[model samples]
Target: MLEDLDALSLRVQRAVQLAQGLQAERADLMAQIQQLQQRCQALQTQQAAERDEFARMSERLARHDLELQAAQKESAQARGTLEIQLHEQRAHAQSLQHSLQASQADCDRLRTAASGAQQQIELILERLPGAEA
Candidate 1:
């Protein structure tokens, strides 16, 4: 009977020890679970921050695109105006060139006519009386 009691007591003690070991293991696992949850939360926060940064950069890119489009429009307008001015200047220069050519032709014609008139007058004077050889 005493031997039976001792065996039963030994089994009880081993069960208690096993229960304690299991409790300790549970505590360690719970701690690990808590740390993993915290790490997950941190990761989520970082993701949120990255999302916000991406949105901000996207907005900046959009604004820059708008600015680029406006600049292109302004540059196109400036180019158009300059082209018009250049065309007018070229037209005016061509007109001036034409006028210069006409004036030069008229001057040459007058000089030739004056030279002919002078020769005719000289011949008439020579044929007249007392005109020397």
Candidate 2:
């Protein structure tokens, strides 16, 4: 009877260990999910800022276009002055446009990366026994 009691106690200890390990793993996974979610939010905010910058750049481009048209119309009276101002404005607009495009591309890339990370986390969670249910 004593031997049987010892065996039963050993089995209970092992079960407890298993449960503890599982709980630890679950906590780790939860922490990872939270960290990933925070990163995703940061990326989303950055994307929004980039989009806003793009909008501002577009507005600036429109204003530059209007200025260019006005400059052309005035060129007949002050050809040299209008031409210089037009060239400068055009150059500035081009630079802003390029910067906007680069920012947009970066935003898209970050969003894609965040999506991939989320998918990987989901996959990991799905593979876990309790998580699947």
Candidate 3:
């Protein structure tokens, strides 16, 4: 009976020791799980922030695209207007050149007529009072 009692007591002590070791291992595992959960939450927050930044960048890119399109349209319109003005200026220059040519022709004709008239007047004066005297 004494031996049996000693064996029972030894068994009880080993069981208590085993239970205490298991409880300590469970506490360590719980701490590890809590740390992993916190890391996951931080990653989630970082991902959300990155997502928001990406959206803002996308919006900015869209606005820039719109601005570029508007600039291109305005440039095209300006080029068209400049082309029209250039054409008009060329036409006006041609018209002025024609007018200058016509005026030059008329001036030449009037100079020829005036020279002929002066020769006739000189011949008439020689035939009149200045004859042989």
- For candidate 3, report its TM-score: 0.75
Q: Which candidate's lDDT is highest? A: 1
Angstrom error of the Cα, residue 96, model 3: value is 1.5
Per-residue lDDT tens digits for candidate 3, residues 1-133, read 9999999999999999999999999999999999999999999999999999999999999999999999999999999999999999999999999999999999999899999999998788778975664
In order, candidate lDDTs are 0.99, 0.96, 0.96
lDDT of 2 at 22: 99
Compute each candidate's TM-score over C-alphas.
Answer: 0.80, 0.51, 0.75
How well does candidate 2 score on lDDT at residue 39?
A: 100
lDDT at 24 for candidate 3? 99
Question: What's the distance in Å from true for residue 93, model 3?
Answer: 1.3
Candidate 2 lDDT tens digits, 18-109: 99999999999999999999999999999999999999999999999999999888876688787888999999999999999999999999
Candidate order (TM-score): 1, 3, 2
By TM-score, the better pick of 1 and 2 is 1
**Where is model 2 more than 4 Å wrong at Cα?**
76-133
Q: Total clashes, candidate 1?
A: 0
The predicted structure with the larger lDDT, 1 or 3, is 1
